[model samples]
Target: MKRLWGILCIMVCCTGELSAQKAAGFKGWFINNVKIANSMRTLDLSEQPAQLQLTFPRYQAHSYLVNMGIAVILNNNTTLNYISDLNVEYHRNTLTDAEQNNFSAGYGFKWRFANAGAADYFMAGDLQYLYNELNATNSLGGTFLLTLFRDGKRLNWNTNNFRLNNRLLFNLAPFAGFQMQEILKSRQNGMAGFILRPEFSINTSLAFCKKAGPPYDKLLAIFCNYTGRDDAINTTSFKEHYTQLLHTGINYYLAYSPFEVSIGASFNDGSDPLNGRTQQQYWQVSVNFLK
Candidate 1:
């Protein structure tokens, strides 16, 4: 199970970041990839809109997670968006005197279809690449045995040494949702007058990796035998495994003109679309600084 856990770590990475060059040439509106159901607002005019998240994962001593995005308006009813997702992490295992570093970056675009009343729809996709390595030593400063998967290309069996694996992955997601604006309005004199926006959406994502072969096929077989179920795996030998993710959530937006905040809970049910074994659901709070 320890070895399985290590393999799982390489498969479950997610997040994005913008390069300094990209930031300098950025133009358009900032919007969350999954939260675009209303008409474009003046807030979308901001040059750069970014999202930051901090997470605490076991054995990871330090980590940074950032998701930054920008959108360009193509017309009254259509918009184009570019987003970057990055995650950088460091892990330390005191029990084995081992350490590892992992990094991944993904950039993608989304097209917002025409909006009709309170309902909205969009089609978006992104490609992500990850590279990581591991090193370990024993009490006598001797090498410890470790094996790692290198982007499905080859396996590395070594000690006190690390190898690189740059895994290439892609995901296509479509979002459909509705928003009821002004569900609540506060009439406070001389104040920005609080307003509430309640929204709901169904999100689905299809993710796949480029490399297809052994272990990949064998891994899918293991999941099948373990789950004792069919249909979830989705692909066979030649195609390896393509994961499907289903995410549903309801969020309430509190806005005071120019500034908005949201709090919501979501239920995310799916396999680790990257062929990893990890799944989670939770609630979150977000403040839109540029809105």
Candidate 2:
């Protein structure tokens, strides 16, 4: 009995030490989002002009999305470190009049070089590629964004393992950024033009569950994004421009061993004029696998 007890004590100590080491090393997560929605109304193809006649179905709108990316923790020395994130999202929207598909991928890196007792100084840049296919119309484009922030740090209450601890409390990342969009193709009255955009975004979250005591297990987040783009004509000089829509969404995440699932919904105003003014609402579900 004495020999057995001694072995058990040694094993417990070893496990504790290993856990501590893991907590101290570089931590990262890869996540994905997939979703589907249905439209609230259907267009009347039999009408004189084939106008869109709104009708409520069992489901309002459906959307599918897949976003997979990894974020790395550089260091934890002084709460100031470098972080990098690479993400890609694929979205498909089926509407009463048309079906739209978009693929977007971007990589971003941020540096937290200084924390002036109350605020953190950070700078980030991201480059994204977008491919959009609208029914018979096809458009290819890309965007480059740059942001600078002096955000105050607070405790993040959300418990999701995919998110960092300081994500929920009272942190504010008030940032200003610029985005440039370049269109590559135009067919079926597609808009192929360049736009200079200014954007602002906010991220907030709530903690729901705890897993390993220190790290949370589940989280809920509210994020808002707004972009304003200036019109730039194409080679054909077709005056095609509209104010970009504002987007707001809520997200929830449940973290498991090597995988996690996220669910979210987003609302956006009309950006393009199909027949008249049109608005879009999207609901999404995503599953992520980490290596």
TM-score of each: 0.29, 0.50
- The residue ranges of model 2 lying beyond 4 angstroms of the native Cα positions read 1-88, 95-98, 105-107, 113-117, 135-171, 188-190, 219-255, 262-279, 282-291
Q: Best candidate, TM-score-wise? A: 2
Model 1's alpha-carbon lDDT is 0.26
Any residue pairs clashing in model 1, and if so which? 15-85, 15-86, 16-85, 16-86, 17-86, 258-291
**Cα RMSDs, all models:** 24.7, 15.7
Clash number for candidate 1: 6
- Model 1 TM-score (2 dp): 0.29
Which structure among the candidates has the greatest lDDT? Answer: 2
